[model samples]
Target: MLHEIGHNLNLDHANSEKGKEYGDLSGAMGHLYASETHPMMCFNAANTFDDLEWYIDRQKIIYKSSYFWEGDLVGVAEYDLCRTGKYVAIKIPKGTYSSRGRYDYYISFNRKILFNSGTMEGGDQVLVHKRYTKSPSKSYLMKKLRSGESYSFQSMTVHVQSISTNTSPGIATVRVTKETPAPVKPVTKHPTSNPTPVPTPGLTPGSTPDPTLNRTLGPTLVPTLGLTLETMLEPTLRPTLGPMERLVEHPMKKPLECSPQQLLKPSVTLQGPLSGKIKHSKSSKAKRPLQHPAYPWNKHSKTSKTKSSLNHPVNFGLENPVWHPVKCNDMLERSCINNPLFFLKVKGRRRNCAWLGRKKWRANRYCKKSNKSRKMVCRECCNSCRICTECSKICSNIKY
Candidate 1:
């Protein structure tokens, strides 16, 4: 019953984790699950007494003595308080022994409560609801009440007669009285007359009329004679090409041919007695300047010939070093020759030709003779595999 009364007072459940679980035993609108004491709205089984009835009776007395009475006088009671468009005043006294839900009572008055109490402390003030129909619950803290203050609402005037703070439960005596309507003065009616119609002069026949007034309302035709001639005589805007266009239009000039005599050759004048002996000194040095001992192509000394020299011989000329085989190993003997040109062609086949031996020679021969056969043979022989001294001899025996 108390819980229902709390709902009537517009009281909501006190929200908390414990309130949601065990019950909000502290507030009047709390639930009674597993709680020993029964607050106003709690559902405890121990609350079997007629205490709620007594509480309702006391509430009725308080309502009759306080702002609820003013609300009743303004045709706003507890049941019809939430009804739209109804306005009433509710007076709440300080230190009143009511339920813990004061917010519920404030909400019940809706916007009727005048929260503005100028120059008065909020704790010491009284709450008086007036003729406002909207809910001030959203912003009720902005206004407060003071003692001996009178607020007029529509035809009713709510006056705070006296506030007795000396009493145990402070009594704020408020009086609600209907305001008397002011007498209105009589308004006198005057007589109105219609004036005579003024005459407008009509256009006389065969008389010149004003051009401004006689002008046609349609759009005026503009003379295109001068405009068309000016547009036709206007110069055409020709697009200009950028520097890149000139660069692309003309082809670049060929580099000038440089003769052997005019070319900047490094001075190779021999300072020693062996000067005229090296005829092609420039070509020889330029072709193979850094001669490694392992490169048989560069090392042309007869005594320094490699072990493969037994199977293939190299010819050293004054101008260029060449390869010539006196006796070829395996089936390659028939294909072997002492051609100086062929020797020159296959001279620097590979940088590591001395170490690679016959495998390198076969790959170089295939590359020169048959371009198609060179692809497979060169790929197999000249790959990542290193020709060891033992493998070089074994490869020399294999016919390509």
Candidate 2:
């Protein structure tokens, strides 16, 4: 009766580390076999209780610890599971979230007291359980730790320092620490060619020249080979080139002589790979710049045509109960059930149309969207539809 009540309250079966359903002997949800005898049956796992978010917020039974991160050095905190109104359990959240989009672990101490009188295996140790956002009612056993024992997961490590049996209610002290990855060394590259010092006409030898006072008259052209053409043209003694080496020259051997204003103006001739001429107007009328075909802001670009999150239609709950049906035979894909998690929070907390028991009218609004969720729930709520003939036998028992 208690277990069935737990299910009605949205609590799913707790699984053991061995992957057995209802195998977590520490909780009331677990069944006792003919050979096993546990007189003291405790409440459900901490994660299962946490799944009832409203209960956790209202009861205020556990102490919610700050999030754990890499390189964090946490102090010891004591927890008493047998009593409430104080810190009965400690919930430790890591910096990471599980695939189900919830904190991965819940730490709680389990000790026999009151209705929890049975001496279960690993009862004295602190138990860790996993939480899933999709199934808040379900929790999986992860680890059982004793004094001086530790459990390492991801970047965080939890250590049990001591278990005190001397107190009326057994207390367990735990410490959390995070291991940060070692820093990587940056690679330093040596410059292929150093900038030539521009000599100031009036500066004395061995004295540093002011860079602002000795700026270059114009930009210097450096080739891909790292040789400055202007510096190479100087009247200095040159080294003899090897037989394997050949000197390359610019395609345009003659330099263009232009006024200072002409150098700042945009050139009409397209250079390099383009090799084209652009039409320029003598009038002061400015023309819009040409955009690349793949540019995101271009109206005709493919990227601009992609649907954005804002374009999705809003879902306002149904005013009346109505059904819209589709021919299952027309569907190219087989009628298959989606993942249990796929329907979770589809319309925000407790607003899921398929899961809504009495308020099914709300489902009418959810099915209006042209998405997978519409098909998954609309067939049942809006219209009575039969399974497709192709996969009828295999999918007969499965619900959308």
Candidate 3:
């Protein structure tokens, strides 16, 4: 019953004697007095009671320390949470509910009670039912005790068969409790990447249980690689070429769809069969900056053309390479260039420099090699998996 109640309170197992999440029971002191006897909160997994009536048709109230044998409990214990110095005691009165097993739990009296009741599928060896609900059982401790120390007490032991059994309506009796607080774990805060734990003294002023503090955590805080809807978030970002290598070095036979940066990052090693400046042939038609034929867009066509007038930048590349409207499918390609990460990169012609864009383009800037060279480049490309010419890889000529 106590365990179920703790579950409702979002508490995990109290038997874990050592952990960093919730305060550690092994290292912490108790809040309850030594005289207030109830079974300490550690023995819930066993069956040591004979009051089966409390689970079937009656309520049975048990006190602290009274249930356990002399050495069953250790020194002082406290509720890891609530910090109250109290030992929780519980009871499920006879006839209150029909259960296949005992319905009593051990806990701190002052701490909130999360009570629960249910029946288990009985078995000849033993019967166990997981808690489904919890409510306060009402008897918790209240007195002076430190968070980690224990009080002295005379040890008491009992034999199960020696005790009188309440064989009335048929339900097993199980009593479990703790004398010392058990350790707890940290919980993750929603929305934020950090986790929070109770504050402690002398924790270095700014030192906190929150992981998100100081070191900023993020998914770049804003969109970078893929298409992301505009958001209210205003976050600064950094650029790295790692994500690109992951794509280019793909072990599978499939081709890689790359961002301009990814393509450039790998070229840094230039260790592949193909190395040095990627040269383009002055042969086949250069991949029109805008591959679509309907709308021949170039650096000059950035401004929109309405019914009124046109504010054009003067498309100077091809006397007429043909213009085409941007397509929905090509958005990924556009995004690679327009990404915040792309803009943040230092623009220049340094080794492994990522191409942001071109201010001025020429008709023969990048063209496919002759079908013959292409055949050779293609053979090399298939084996080396690197670009030497337009036809070698990144074929803008392939209309999407």
Candidate 4:
């Protein structure tokens, strides 16, 4: 019986702080290790590279995905491929672009990483060549697969939409990322370095064992690693299960059961098109929650009177610091801008870690303090940014 090793190997979930998730790779697991694409010691996925052979012939990856809201169909892990990682090219289905070749396609290696993060980098991946746009896998690009390394297409996800084998096209138009099969005869002999010597019960002296089972999937390709050429090219369908899905007792607070009223009579409730989009905002001073466009700061201090002098702030009566009016999309606070935790700004939403205000130069600390870090939740938008409860604590305790 062929045994799977890595799945039970105990690597921590992507956002976790400690345990096997942070273990070194060399002999940690098996498969193989050649390059240091990034260091795993740091919190950022950019700092993670879980590449070690860890004693295995091969294994397939499956992800269970879901769509959080409408128009967010990332259910298929192939979606991640459209962004890093080695992949066989796929045709852009008819619909996405009005003009052919005008758009681009790629498989993202680290979706949560800011490929284009640093100042030097307007962002990562922004400048990289569109690896997946071209159709029919080319031989030159075949080197990546031939190297015996299986690059990841997506990590597990909790908030965004994901595709499933059962997903309908009404929500999204996703094609499966399929593998191309190798032309050579498949190898069965389990050639490995850690020769614990599984007693091949029926092997001839010089005869090799057959290649690992196909475990073929149906349509969408699951991002694979350390796979054989046959595994790479075979048109494997993804598990109807989203390759990377997490189930939570989604807060009952979500209005999943309550939607806007339409069938009710006018007497049931008075309804009219609300003139504007109401939102939530916080005051610089300690104050209770208030409506958006707060009468105090949103009335357009003199600077908001007209588009002229767009950068200047209009004077207001309250002595509150004249917060420079920033476009809703840009709201990194002064503390965030200056804090060593600047990674919070550089990294976008849903990422596991944020650069909290660290005190010293390059030194950093565990963002969570006591024991409750894993269950933390953070929102992505500026108006609804989520931060760890411990962030406030660690930010204050660490030396820097």
Candidate 5:
């Protein structure tokens, strides 16, 4: 069922050099067996996620040919398996130019635990797979490396410095090195003959010539007309009217709608200069409720007997100031969500509020005053229910 799901996700079988089909044992797409007791199998290969457009979601470190040109020995990069905070895999393009590269290599650290327990063979090793750029579903397993092992191809070498497979989520440090690329020769274009300069138009006789127009116009290039000070000095198309002659103006032309009295006294509907005087009557002012300074920020009001926590605002410092009552909805849209790969269980098989914000009933149990991680991750969710709400107090001594 798992292997077929990979097929549904546009992932082909993981192939190997022995000519036997489904030979790669590191991924579930390869030859595998499932029993009733151990129904869950291994996760799909990193290449499968790449094909599904989860490149950023899976956190893949892509190294191009230009990376080698930047410096020698492009340092040992660490990859944490199934962790959102760190990279899960590394990808390298086949050719010098990444855009034109026909093939791409993906390296990932695989382990035997949870879903990956089905494949017992070569479970604790870094697996490398090559995929054709044009056909993403076609993936070929190239090599498997243990600690200190290295793989070489097309003048580029990937060396595994160290790997820890015993941990919950394994960590692998790998370094990429390449041969110094040959310096490219600069191309120079020369004209057959000297080009003539085009004279700028609409310029005064004594005015300085336009700097751009002074440049030599090439035979193949077209010159644009230039407008200078001479264009502005031309006579006006229409004459202006005098204050005394304004009485004999055209009847079709509309007069100003705003009177001088309306400008001086603004109305209640418009408290600005455009309308008349805006003043609240005694009866209307008496009906308006008076709010205490502390009651707006704090949920527990001393004067009111009502249990509603609607007016309470969450303060996130001067930068964000206050999260308004209506706009306090979760700012973490699917696009900006930095959710973890696996739903890590806390306590007794329960997930944290940060991971379960969308599922309100399941998240309510974890949204406690003691859960400090909840405030940092799901602030909007916590603020909505007036649970464990507090103002952000940044230290003046510290620079963030």
Candidate 6:
């Protein structure tokens, strides 16, 4: 994964096919698996040293140069190269020119890259060169400086002591010295107060009072006192008319009369355009009672009676006075065989069959015999069975 990532970062395979044979794993490229030791390129799960040196050398030479500079008594005319984290070189000329005034020229360096260009050289000492020119444009001519190179112009000379291309492009120290001084200016003192005092109009020694001030400040004592005295001497006056009589009134007009002929004529009723017919009140119309559908249990009651009659002892020849066994085929018969107490007992009391007293002949014949046994088999043989009744009466004379 790391090898593929190195390839994405624009790193190519090494030239040699050997592994870590000679303490240098920088040439282990194009192989399937690299040695587990050092960092290298083009190997699976391997760490080689070649990638580290390649990045370090690339960052050393990769830098952007600026065209602007700053210094005291010097106007810097340079370009701003917008890049950081790399080494760079800046060239500043030392000369004097008079555009606004006479300004001495020199170079000032700092750690921060103002306008993106600052001191990017990574070394303990940086060498500078001096170039002399009669014109300001000629002073800007700067060439690339190599390691251990020296340049001289007029009385000033610059020497390249050493250049470093391997150090990180971080904070570095810079040296600045005064190459020229600025011209001096003359000084003058200003007066503290005015020489002559101007006089104010009303406040002056013999000036007359203004006419506008006299009109605003004059008093009206006589007219105010005369009006108050006149009101006190005046007599009270009484009203001659009442409130109702004093109101203005107009004469009343006679109302117009109507004839009987006009009253006998029919008045036409106004109808809306969308009205279909007039709606009558609910009290004015006859109402009928609402009917509901019959219940499901009522419709099944007749069918249930026929099924119950099939289980009666009369159909099984129990009416001959001798008890006979009825077949346990229907649901009531099966219920009687399975649960005898359901038909023979009512809650806790034993009673005769429910149909014993209802039918005239069966009620008179077995009304007394139905109390002998509270079993459903006795009721089935006696021909007095009643399945839908609440009574628990059974025929006691019959055997199970």
How does each model score on TM-score?
0.19, 0.36, 0.16, 0.16, 0.38, 0.14
When summed lDDT is taken over every stretch of 10 residues in candidate 4, the lowest stretch is 138-147
Cα lDDT tens digits, model 5, 350-371, are 2333323322223332222244
Per-residue lDDT of 1-400 in model 6, one digit per residue for the tens?
4435546644444222122222212212232245454332222111111223322221221012322222111101111221343223332332312223221222111122222132223112332312222321111112223344434333223344334323333222222222332335756587567765866556558777676744465786666634566677887676333212211110112221322122111221213211222222233222221110111012323323222222233211111222222222121221221122323222233343332322111222222334342222222312222221112222123322
Q: Of the candidates numbered 1 and 6, which has the greater TM-score value?
A: 1
Model 2's alpha-carbon lDDT is 0.43
Q: What is the lDDT of candidate 3?
A: 0.26
- Please report, in order, the local distance difference test score of every candidate based on alpha carbons: 0.30, 0.43, 0.26, 0.25, 0.45, 0.26
**C-alpha lDDT of residue 137 in model 6:** 13
Best-performing candidate as measured by lDDT? 5
Candidate 3 residues 103-208, lDDT tens each?
3322111111121111111111111111223332222111112222232212211111111112211222223322333446888677675665866666466655
User: Over 4 Å off in model 4, which ranges?
Assistant: 1-225, 234-383, 391-400
| Residue range 122-188, candidate 4, lDDT tens digits | 1111111112222311101111111122322222111112322333211222223323233378897
Q: State the displacement of the C-alpha of residue 301, model 1, in Å, after optimal TM-score superposition.
A: 99
Deviation in Å, model 4, residue 149 alpha carbon: 80
Assess the local accuracy of residue 320 in candidate 2 as a C-alpha lDDT between 0 and 100.
18
Which regions in candidate 5 have their CA more than 4 angstroms from the true location?
32-39, 43-46, 61-85, 96-101, 180-400
- Candidate 6 to truth, TM: 0.14
**Candidate 1 accuracy as TM-score:** 0.19
Global CA lDDT of candidate 5, please? 0.45
